[model samples]
Target: MTTNKSQDSLQQQLASLPQDVQPGRDLWQGIELAITQQPSATDKAKPKSWVYGAVAASILVPAVAVWISISSLSGPVEPGLDSAALIAQLSEQYESQKSSLLVTYQDKPALTDNWQSQLTELEDAAAAIKSALKHDPNNVALLRMLQTVYQQQIDLIERVHAPKWQQI
Candidate 1:
């Protein structure tokens, strides 16, 4: 049919065309010349400002974030109450209470044999938090965590030595 003949003719024409072709001149010379040239004054000045801005933002963004986080973590301290002094006061109170509780429970045996080990673990955790506090003394969350851990230790000591009926 005429359609088949036209298709064959098109395929023959495509096959007859040269497969390999070359430019009349070397194109790399122009590209090489362009790449080797220096940028104009406007282009140079524009990029410098943009680069400086990007560099400054890179440095400042993290600094601002750190400032915000530290401020928020420390929050607003009460008038005349320093974080370190408050921590020391609370620690002293906790120690006093813990010592008195231990003295009261010295004669009594704990209900569970592993209570001492559990207390040791809590003590270790408290020590780690205290170490962190030394670095970030004003962190309220760490202060609360230390208080909670101390309370847990006290509760553990009291509960372990309490009478069976009282436990219920």
Candidate 2:
């Protein structure tokens, strides 16, 4: 009797169970649906990426500004012309204008009058170039040319006006 009862229970359990041992299509579909609905790690990292972007911008802005400042301060440099050449060119122009400059002046009683003013302008320009030469002693060609121009200007002025009252 016991053996028959045991067999009957086993048969009832087997009838209640599903035929397939593996999961159904609905179970696999539910698992895939749940995984697809979850949030990704990249979405959480967006704010961190923005922070890194800010850091990069902060560093780049100052570097660009410093580069521009340096470039502007130096200005453009010509390959052939140095500071000495610039001084010589200015001195040449000064000498070329000396005759016309003196003629424009009229005889006046005050020492500060006509000729004096023109001389003063030439003197100032020469002084500035001389000062620049002191800082750059290597440009011998420019230095020699400027000295010659300055000496010539002085000699011409002395030769032209010998009598003090004739100039007056």
Candidate 3:
């Protein structure tokens, strides 16, 4: 067949071609000079790696020893004051002061608009958080929120009454 004859001729032509052809520019001299200019990186890294390991060990050994010593010397810390009772006592104080301030400022002109409304909002938030605490007595976050709202109520009461209202 013509296909088989053409395939055989192409193989014969490929076989007749030269195996190696020389490049016009010389390349060996630059390669030899570069090799002679420096030692292998692996050889240089051997001593450098040993020095780095020694430095790391020197720093880490003392730090680890100090940490172990300090940990062994300290006793366990004491737990803090009872948050529930503390909140209740502070709340009582704030309510007493707030009642007196309300009586004093009942007829006075407020410096800021809707200041009473702000106090009422804070009181509402505190009441809600306190009711939540009654249901979830051991909730830390609820206790913290109740304390924060109570403090806000006290601060609002003091601010609206004392400094500005006293001058008037």
Q: What is the C-alpha lDDT of each candidate?
A: 0.75, 0.56, 0.65
Pitting candidate 2 against candidate 3, the one with the higher lDDT is 3
Q: lDDT by residue for model 1 over 7-87, one digit each (tens)?
A: 999999999999999999999989998999898887765545676687467535544543454354465755565667656
lDDT of 1: 0.75
In candidate 2, stretches whose alpha carbon ends up further than 4 angstroms from where it belongs are: 1-74, 104-125, 137-168
Report the C-alpha lDDT of model 3 over 28-47, residue by residue, as the tens digit: 99998998888877777555
Q: Is candidate 1 or candidate 3 better by lDDT?
A: 1
Clashing pairs in 3: none
Which of the predicted structures, 2 or 3, would earn the higher TM-score when compared with the native?
3
Clash pairs for candidate 2 = none
What's model 2's lDDT at 52? 60
Instruction: Output the number of the TM-score-best candidate.
Output: 1
TM-score each candidate: 0.50, 0.27, 0.41
What are the runs in model 3 whose C-alpha is more than 4 Å off? 1-90, 104-108, 163-168
Q: TM-score of the candidate numbered 1?
A: 0.50
Ordered by lDDT, highest first, the candidates read 1, 3, 2
